[model samples]
Target: MGLSYEELMDKQQWLADELTKSIKAEFNKQNIVIANGIGRNRDGALDFSLSISDLDNPDQSPDVELIDFAKAKMKELVPDSDANVVGVPTPKQF
Candidate 1:
């Protein structure tokens, strides 16, 4: 049998939460925070379009340096996985 809607939602949330934590934890900075994610891709890996909050300056747009740092860190974390880090945030998924 297939999973219920609630079950699926829970699973999705759980995955998202774990992904967020893992990503955030790898980033050893205090100014970044997780905003939201568009859920994982249907592909073979745990891909998601993520957003992050810039604690130092949340109102302004994302800095290019910050985004690059995020992408690099992500690559380091999941180098072999097919999980692509879609969006690095204008500032908001920790």
Candidate 2:
């Protein structure tokens, strides 16, 4: 049976938290934010996207190795999710 929308969202949230913790453990100084979403891809398969951003240092370049590591770890956590990681600027706070 397919997971309900809420269950998928919960899983996404859990994955995000796990990724955040894992990354932070290695890169303690960086302000890392891991945002994730679960949705269907073009082929209608379950897919996910993880956005890893440094909120405090947007100008500084992100570490490619770190992103790759995060992607790998995310994939290990959810084998079914075709997870993609991208760097995005932090939204301006009001």
What TM-score do all the candidates reach, one by one? Answer: 0.45, 0.74
What local lDDT score does residue 77 receive in model 1, on the 0 to 100 scale?
A: 49
Residue 57 displacement (Å), model 1: 1.0
Top candidate when judged by lDDT against the true structure: 2
State in Å the error of residue 37, model 2. 1.6
Off by over 4 Å in 2: 1-7, 40-44, 92-94
Model 1 has an lDDT value of 0.49
Q: Give the TM-score comparing model 2 with the true structure, all chains together.
A: 0.74
* lDDT per residue as tens, model 1, 1-94: 3333454445444544554565456555556655433334446333434465556565664566655655565555434333334433343457
lDDT of each: 0.49, 0.74
Q: What is the per-residue lDDT of model 2 for residues 49-90, given as tens digits with 9 covering 90 to 100?
A: 677888677755457877888888877887666656777777
